[model samples]
Structures are given as C-alpha cells and as structure tokens.
Target: MFEKDQDKEEWTLSATLESPASVIASGFGLDTAVGEELIVVKAIRGEIYAYETDLSTGAWLLSAEVSVVDSSYVSSRPWNQARDIPSLFQRVFLIRLED
Candidate 1:
C-alpha cells in the first residue's frame, strides 16, 4: 500500500515480500532458505521506518529508522552484524527522487 497526499507533500509506502529468499539471493548473491519479511514507511520530512519480521509467524524481528541525509541508523532491536545497511537499502528499497 502506498499513499500520497500531494497537497501536504506526505507519502507512505508499505510492501510485503513473500519470497524474500529469492529476492535476497538475486540482489545480494547470498544463498539461503530462511524466510524474511520487511515493511517500510517514509514520511515527507525524510525519515524512513523499516521493520523486519518472521514470515511464518508474523513476529517482529527488527525495527530501524534512518534519515535521508544521515547514514547512522537506529535500530530498536539488536542488529545483525552480518547485514550491511547500505546494500540492503539499495537492493530492497531502491529509493529515488525525480523532478
């Protein structure tokens, strides 16, 4: 689900990836059979909210946020050191702005 309020310059986006393994495999070249779920929301001011969950049980795994101009990400849960933040954003979100 994605909504945009043009007059207010506000927008929200939500997506569910059922086949996260395939996507990750293609995007990062990592081979794994684990199931992962992700949800992301962005506000007009440049704050991005991301959530990761268990695909099977819908339990929350990790929650994080990042500012458009900042690379420092804050996570509500302990983050996995093996995952690279920038690469995940590029491959999963692929956010872009156009005039």
Candidate 2:
C-alpha cells in the first residue's frame, strides 16, 4: 500500500503484508501447498486488485484490476475481449471521482 505525500509530490510506502501466506489463507480461505502457485488478491476501499509474483525470485509479474462478487475473484478479461473498456488506471481514476 502507498500514500501520496502532497508536499513531496511523490508516493510513500504506507503498509505491507507481513505474511502473504497468512493473508491468502484468511482472505481467500485457501491453504497454500508446497510448490503451489498463487496470485495475491487485495481489496483496497472496496476495489479489488490482483498481483502475480514469481515465487522463486519474489519478482512482480503483473498487476491488474479484478472483479469480486460472492466471494469469487474474476480475472481480467483478455485484451481482445476488452478492447472497448477503459484501461485499468483510467477506470480506477473514474471510481475515485465517483467517490
């Protein structure tokens, strides 16, 4: 998580997840297994985002907006299927405006 420092005109790190395993276990109600692959899903102010990471190197792979309904997380649609939709950042900005 991050917060913008208006005076500095930059984003600052706010908080972080100490244990991704615990978070995934609680939030998604799934127990991780050895050598299992997983994607982390985070909800910030009711908006859902997913982060894919390389388990071996801890490198970030991708981040995308996701939809959650009835405890299910829907992955982003393929580009070909979502050509008409606004980009993720644009949609997030629009949501902030609505708020």
Candidate 3:
C-alpha cells in the first residue's frame, strides 16, 4: 500500500502483504465488526481474505482469512462450464510457458 506523506506530493510504500496473491474477485459487505467496513477478496486458487480499513490511519488491515480445509482449492461457487473450461485450458497453457 502507498500513502502520501503530509506536505509531500510523492507517495510512499507504507505496508506490504506477507503473502501476495492475484485478486480474482472482491465485494463490500456488512459484518459483525462493530460498525467497521469489510472488504471481501476472493483470490486466485479460491483463497479468501477480508480487509478492514482504519479510518484513523487510512490503511487497510487484514482482519481474516478463509482457507481451504481440504487439499483442493476449488471453491463451491457455481461456475459456467463453457467459459470456465476454456479459461482453465488457458491457465494451463500459461503455466506451461517456457523460454
């Protein structure tokens, strides 16, 4: 995350994720956080992360993580067989990229 220092035009890197993953989807939701805003992020490979913003600090904090209890990373959300199959093939092809 980047933030601007007081009286400065440049943005500085303030925080970094311990384990960064590509964000596949995200949505805002109301949770039992005592009025805190929640942002739900579904990452690539079906891992989920929740972020809460600190109104005082202007920074996002990782409040929770939903990991797979099993070995599979596939999520339970409904998927489109037609588009999903092609996308899966594309991902496989990209993973096989070589110099």
Candidate 4:
C-alpha cells in the first residue's frame, strides 16, 4: 500500500491483470516499503509490477509474491462505470508462499 507522505493518505494504483501471476511494481515510479523491505512498482504497458530493491545498484529488480487483484473491493467502490454490477461477491484471501 502506498500513501502520501505529507498527509498519510492511502493511494491506489489503477492496473489491469489478465493473468494470475507474480508482477513487479516499478512503472509507477514509487517505492513500496513494508517494514524493512523496500520495493518498486513498475508499469509496463497496461500492467503494474512489483520489483525488489537492489541495494548495490539502487534499482528495483523483479521479485516475488506481489499479486494484483482486479475487481477487488479495494479497487471497486460505490460502483464502476465501465463494468456491470457483480451478482455474487466472494471472499478473497491473500497468502504468501515463503513468508
């Protein structure tokens, strides 16, 4: 999750995920930090990615376990003007393989 440093507000990135896979976040040109781990989300074409921060090179390289959820509740709200309303909303669980 990325937030504005000045006001501490949550920020959301708009992305599209056609396949279920790990992505690198770098194109957004923002740094992602969860505790001591820092990363970058890169946008390639219409997709967003998450990349591991390279301490030696000062760059964000590809890493693992970053999932992009399309049509998620976090991404959807009030309603989406582009798509029809969902009939069945199911629960979602995000699990890390090698925590």
Best by TM-score: 1
lDDT of 4 by residue, 1-99 (tens): 333334532233433222224332222222222222323333323333334434454322235556443434322422112132131121111111121
Off by over 4 Å in 1: 6-8, 13-18, 22-37, 41-43, 52-70, 74-99
Q: How would you encode candidate 3's per-residue C-alpha lDDT over 5-61 as one tens digit per residue?
A: 467333232222222232222112211111234323222242332234345544354
Worst 10 residues of 4 by lDDT: 87-96
What does the lDDT come to for candidate 2?
A: 0.30
Candidate 2: pairs in clash = none
Tens digits of per-residue lDDT for model 1, 1-99? 335556665543333334433322222321222233333322234343444443343333334434342235422222222243444332333211111
**TM-scores, in order shown?**
0.29, 0.27, 0.23, 0.24
Number of clashes found in candidate 3:
0
Q: In candidate 2, what are the lDDT values of residues 1-99, reduced to their tens digit?
A: 345545643332222333433221221222221112334433344353444445455434223534343222323322111222222222221111000
Evaluated against the true structure, the overall lDDT of model 4 is: 0.29
Candidate 1 Cα RMSD after full superposition onto the native fold (Å): 9.8
lDDT of 2 at 51: 42
Q: Which parts of model 2 are misplaced by more than 4 Å?
A: 1-24, 27-37, 55-99
- Clash statistics: count for each candidate: 0, 0, 0, 13
Q: What is the C-alpha lDDT of each candidate?
A: 0.33, 0.30, 0.26, 0.29
